[model samples]
Target: MKVQVLLRTEGELAVVVGEAEGETWPEMQTVLPALLRGVADRVEAHGEVPDAAP
Candidate 1:
């Protein structure tokens, strides 16, 4: 599987986008959280914290 991740930040807020091809929706869904967490971890390492949904 191939995954692509995009990150956007505005001040202290950050948004993440993840994309993958060659996978079923269920398969993609299963892998997304880990991908997103990895991206989030990298972003946070640079001192940007993503906004939490309320």
Candidate 2:
């Protein structure tokens, strides 16, 4: 899988994420929680973070 991080703002941010080709959405779903938590923590602590896209 490939992970791309994006900085949205000083206090709020977004993560631009995508998996490698042939990866299933279900598979990605498995790790979403961890990814989101990590992003939230980083955003809170650092003021900028990245996460999965809608």
lDDT at residue 11 of model 2 (Cα atoms): 75
Q: What lDDT score is found at residue 13 in candidate 2?
A: 62
TM-score of 2: 0.47
- After TM-score superposition, the amount by which residue 21's alpha carbon in candidate 2 deviates from its true location, in angstroms, is 7.7
Minimal lDDT window, size 10, model 2: 13-22
Q: Which one wins on TM-score?
A: 1
Alpha-carbon local distance difference test for all models = 0.69, 0.56
Error of 1 at 36 (Å): 0.5
Off by over 4 Å in 1: 1-3, 8-22, 48-54
For model 1, how does the per-residue alpha-carbon lDDT over 1-54 read when each residue is reduced to its tens digit?
666777866765445466666557778788788788877676677875669321
